[model samples]
Target: MIQRKIPSAEEAEKLKALGLAVINKEAEAVAALAGRINGNFAQACCHMLACEGRIVVTGMGKSGHIGGKIAATLASTGSPAFFVHPGEANHGDLGMITGKDVVLAMSNSGETAELLTILPIIKRLGVPLIALTGNPASNLAREADVHIDISVAHEACPLNLAPTSSTTATLAMGDALAVALLEARGFTELDFARSHPGGSLGRRLLLHISDIMHTGSEVPVVREQAQLRDALIEMTNKGLGMTAVVDARGRLTGIYTDGDLRRTLDREIDIHGCRVRDVMHTGCKTATPDMLAAQALQIMQENKINALLIVDRQQRLTGAINMHDLLRAGVV
Candidate 1:
């Protein structure tokens, strides 16, 4: 075995410089691609927008990884897309493609054998093809209806053989396509949230107060004329640390909470005979059941209140929500 020499700090720094140089070179390549985004890019976007079927993304090896991510970004940003591994496409996954679908293929050399093997099938199926590759003269680009040139000056790799800069260029191109489609389709944050229902954005956008608020008889409520002891019992039963004090007509009068109880006790007020109206807080912050949980959180934070009484336009109590509700709904 030959003895290997360990790199010194200076050598490591040189490697770091080279790595950064690679990124800069690749970034320039990406910038060049952006400059070329004119009619062809617009046409590609129009093709995808008019597509009745899904966008099928395919690649092999490193390109496959980038393709998968591109598909996910497209799907979440208003375009319907999914990745089909080229190796698997020949085996059976080709069934997922149809005449109405569009194929976006990625390859640095533009001659990935596995990808080339599926190009003819995709063409036979009459699927429009968009190729992303470094070589504009390569077979994949030649056969493609729209070829996105992602050519780079050099690889970040010292040996100039690795897929570093090429992959970065491909990923950036994917982002451009996804974002362009996103803008052209007028895809809103709410629409994106629907595609990511399990994410935090989904919770913030889709969760309504009615979905998480304590409703019906579960809402802690007491008459304003009721004694503090009765209000305390209601708060205890509901376990919300607060209770709504309403009038005889079931309209909101005030709110009684553990904080109110603390202040009342500090003042040595008699809990047994004191009317809830005497100690309850008036003009407490409130929310509607249809409000977003994120809005409710903002209300709570602004007012420094942990609970809110949900009411209708008539001021009649409809439900109640607390910080715990927001927390449980992942809105906090």
Candidate 2:
């Protein structure tokens, strides 16, 4: 076995203090951005809101990383947007920008050579240019239609050279812009879920009981007049640990579950002689086919039940689901 060396107490404390210092600096930088959300920021948002084409985000190096995330947030929040690397733009990706689009360029120094090379072309396209940079007086900022200052007082890096506090402030500013546009566009949680259908939030919001429930022949069901042994057979065949008990009209009357079977055995009742209705529990919790699966999960949890029967307005048994079904569907 390989043994790992542990830091001395003094070294551990020093490392912790350094980490805390970095966090404090970054926090201060983000806090300072709240004051800068003034006219320039509003102008930038207006340009983006009025854009007929996608919001094209461009940056180099660390700024590019932040730009990609900002573009994704904007896209997911209902503002059509994408990231275009400035380096690639200079090498033929410049064709990606069009006159109807809005360009959001980021550079801490506002002087990335790759970004500067494509500035004139972006200008000629007549698209609105929004600049985010630490240096307000730099050429890119001066040439931009609207500039939002992302400057920070100090770098968290000990040498004050690496992009630390500046990157954090830039990311925070991007978030503010995305959220502002999201609110302005009246983007709702449903809109966000539509864009993220494969995500957990989407599953919780969009997936209905009908989508995951076992329907028709797959539903474990037994008539109220069925013998207890017959209900047990249905449960065993369907493998949902329960069987919905219905009347002659096919409307649900109650449910007979494995638990009920156990209670019947404990009471020394005759499974062959007793009817399912005699041992079935009525007033069972039920759900509609259109009910959200997440809500179904909640119903099962609150009722302390493992399975649920889905019915329509007529109370006819349409489908059935259990906790394992929810777990398999990622709704658990």
TM-score of every prediction relative to native: 0.88, 0.92
Clashes of each: 0, 0
| 107-152 per-residue lDDT for model 1 (tens digits) | 9999999988888788899878999899989999999999888888
List model 2 lDDT by residue over 90-144, tens digit each.
Answer: 8899999988999999999999999899999999999999999999999999999
Superposed model 2: Cα runs more than 4 Å off:
1-3, 262-270
Measured with C-alpha atoms, the lDDT of residue 188 in candidate 1 is: 97
Per-model CA lDDT versus the true structure = 0.91, 0.95
Residue 26 lDDT in model 1? Answer: 77
Report the alpha-carbon TM-score of model 2 versus the true structure.
0.92
Q: What are the runs in model 1 whose C-alpha is more than 4 Å off?
A: 1-26, 262-272
At residue 278, candidate 1 shows an lDDT of 91
Q: Which ten residues in a row have the lowest lDDT in candidate 2?
A: 255-264
